[model samples]
Target: MAAAGWAPPRLPGFILTERLGTGTYATVYKAYRKTDTREVVAIKCVSKRSLNRASVENLLTEIEILKTIRHPHIVELKDFQWDSDHIYLIMEFCAGGDLSRFIRMRRILPEKVARIFLQQLACALKFLHDHNISHLDLKPQNILLSTPENPQLKLADFGFAQYMSPWDEKHVLRGSPLYMAPEMVCCQQYDARVDLWSVGVILYEALFGRPPFASRSFAELEEKIRSDRAIETDLVVEAVKKDQEGDASAALSLYCKALEYFVPALYYESDARRKEAIRAKVGQYISRAEELKALVTSSSKSLLQQGNPARELLREMAKDKPRLCAALDVASAAIAKEEEGKDDNDTLKLYQHSLGELLLLLAAEPAGRRRELLHAEIQALMARAEYLKDQMKMREAQSMGKEALAEPVRSTCTLQ
Candidate 1:
């Protein structure tokens, strides 16, 4: 049931300022910590009455996952408390809203922008898979944008994320129908690859403005998914093929490559081999890029369309002005040289160079002026740097996919 028009119950030491959003099991609110200089956070309140046995089990599982995992792209859980009637979770506030709303508003994001978001998603998923955790619900709705200015993306909503042992089998069929993987639709014992499939669907949606597979009803959606149809790849191919034209095109191409790398192999008989290849490629890319990818896509009509004044201002600040121009030159050279080879050591060196320059830029300003101007500038630069890093990673991932295609086929058939 909805909580009295989306208003969260007030709690001690935390003031509920505004309702953030609501879901089936909980109502999220924007709250300020009174004891910590009014630091803002997102609070999710799940009523005991709203959670069934399975939901409670899920909540516990989420707690376990959150407690054990830590990463820049993952949402941070700060604290949790339970009253007689409900459970409360305090989390970092993502000012930019969820990816679903962003997509609906933007219609579709540029392929380059979408790829940046996907790379981050993949890195986060890779971490989760490595730990044997499957985020059963892997849709745009659960991906939150960290800030409009910085465009950082983070995954949220662990209600359907489950811990899977290496030897265990997954049989539960849950998640939005349009995004469900083939194995999940068939109710077969699946694995972490199912999440990869979901990532493919979401990535497709990010570029095309619609889900890869869609039907009017649940049955039809399931039927479509099981049919193993490959959506038209033309848009992505076109975006990538035009890379020679400019920065935007090159960015788009990298994103297309990342999408191609993670696409589910269900439609292709060579899926298992391809997945292995992708895994190896992802590792190589991660090593080369020296940073995880994170992409944020907002509705085209939102701030993206409004024109980024902060970004524009920074660009102007760096223009032909010799001194500022030199810094840009140094930063660009370091990034370019760092990505010159696929060697892991070279990649780390490049990451360090870029990171140092970034930190230096942040430190250049005096403390008094730092908070208002320098902080925003540094965030923008970091976000842009992150985008470039992801593009390189995308290329590496595609290279791996190509290598997989060259490998001998291996049977992935298994009994549940």
Candidate 2:
């Protein structure tokens, strides 16, 4: 009986064929023009009664964004109309449905396929980035596929999007909790970087068939993103085992990762005794990590000097470009200094200097083999610099924490 009574909304100049989809406040239907061309389009009919003040503003913003932009990967809004009871938006009819259905059909995507999809998504994001627009709600359900054959991703749902500069920060909640950044969930100010974090989660889900947290509760996801205590514990245990086994290089990397998580743990600790205990552990980690930095430096230098075909080839490729050649040489010197077991401060400076030069080079580098090599080198240097930076912070925190622990622990009991 329910199926027998279904009827599409009445609209002029178009013949409604079937119901395509539905949401909380709107229903979409496949329709065709009544003219000779019979142009097909998807009409999103939003009930006027369902929209409040905020939703009306969001709807206007979405229309303005879609009207002004013309990217291949972003959904298009051709026109809009309003009657007594409802508002209608005429959108491009995508034959292949949204990305959520695509992923559900495949269970998991191959790495190559996933990478291609990610590249397309990045192109769309870069366009938005150039315009200073943040699609605060980026999820699989909001990404549509343009066609059934050779389907291309079209980022949709700008209901929560906003024009935000990189340095502009806000604390208002704007996204699904499952894909939101820790800073957003914790009521802390967050900027455009939240989009990058969502992209990472989407990529992970594409490759693995589910998110990293799977079916975990929001609290568990929050802990994983914020404190990361369990992850830190696992990493440090492995780091210690590696250190005992004399693998200084691997241990150093693991220790740095563990130290990054300890920052939050220290910030949230309330008990005096527990804070002291955590600080003692951190101090021990700082000592070993510092020693390993020197050992790893010399070990890496020798090994790198023995064989670094990639670096040598890159240097050779840049022989014609003097500025690029200079940047490559600076990178080489950074490696050499690390290999020579030089001071960590000096080595870190060299790495950062090279990175600044190389990043500039990369932005102007054309699409080709050399450009690909340059990008890879930049990524490697960025990772190294981040690790070194984390270690440096750990050392500073150890000093401050030790000083704080100098005083005797105060009991919670109040004196009468």
Candidate 3:
């Protein structure tokens, strides 16, 4: 039923380059867009004959969800088309392959690495949950890596995903058994929390090289999950302790990790109390990094003044602040514009990393007389960030108001 090894000679603007993989009902290929600077994309070609009515609905559902949601950690659906015989879904090409393949190449990842991946996963899940979508199927095979060297993950494959509500009573049995929550395995009602449980399982496997429940049989797996058997792991905590003692580089890295976890919560979260809680965490991560960076900066400055051997490298590091701040200011301004909402996540991430670097530089400045100047600069940056945030809120409000106004017009026209 799949369109395996069936690449058409002429597919409009796309030139099929190579076959990436074959699934049950479709074949994914690397393709180049002829009209757009030959940009590459992963195209999934599915045979129309392969899908029944239910299967077609599922395929459309996936497309609709991708069209509605936009987040950095989610795989992008570049374009899609349907002819008489086939349906093609053009997606972002992830070079590093799937998470499952990554794990196979390296038996187990380090805690710090796993923490970064987990944070990205959490961000994607949080964004989906905010929109009331439940990704019933959450597994390593569905997590695609953007690059191998500096890994960035994008959550893909929404075949079993569905809209969910907090008060919904229906429970459907879906998802892979190995990573499935106990509620799903037991046919009990579940909500968005199931995704969090899957993340926990993934984190455990990433840290320990194996899942907590690695049963040979389905019965055994169900029993393990039902019995509430677990393994305790504190790799993140251990890694954080070590990082806390390190120099500026480690501190800067930690700050990025913190933002990985914080940014999604800050943007998607709705509850006032919960937002305050997340903000406290954000403050804690930033504060610790700033403190550690100050010490590193002061020591380096002292050595540089004495004509230390590593003076050149220290000098380069010191000069990075203003350049980073300038770039951040541009990103912040982009966030203030209504038309740039689609790229807000990327801009926010750039701004966040730059802010962290700027704060590090401020902490490192050893001149007691120049301390107030650095503090004022940091304050100005903070003020700009706050202003951008307010701008985003205003944009959202205006958008909603426009929609509200349009609704009445549509209703009146319909009545006429």
The list of candidate 1 runs beyond 4 A from truth reads 1-4, 228-416
TM-scores, all candidates, are: 0.58, 0.55, 0.54
For all candidates, what are the clash counts? 6, 1, 0
Q: Each candidate's lDDT (Cα)?
A: 0.69, 0.78, 0.68
Residues forming the 10-long window of minimal summed lDDT in candidate 2: 407-416
Q: Specify the highest-lDDT model's number.
A: 2
Q: TM-score order of candidates, best first?
A: 1, 2, 3
Residue-level lDDT for 37 in candidate 2:
88
Clash pairs detected, candidate 3: none
Candidate 3 global CA lDDT score = 0.68
lDDT string for model 1 (1-416, tens) is 23566656867888887788878989898888988478989989998998889988989998888878887788989989888888999898999999988989988888788989999999998888888888889999999999976588899988889887556777887787788888888778887778888998898788778897767997887776655334444444554454334435344445445545344342244555445545554344333222223222222114323433564455565564455445545545544553463554454455456557656666665565323554664554455455456555566655555555555555545312
Candidate 2: segments with Cα more than 4 A from true spot: 1-6, 229-416
Estimate the TM-score for candidate 3.
Answer: 0.54
| Residue range 16-83, candidate 2, lDDT tens digits | 77787788788888889899988888888889999999889888888888888989898888899889
TM-score of 2: 0.55
In candidate 3, stretches whose alpha carbon ends up further than 4 angstroms from where it belongs are 1-10, 232-416
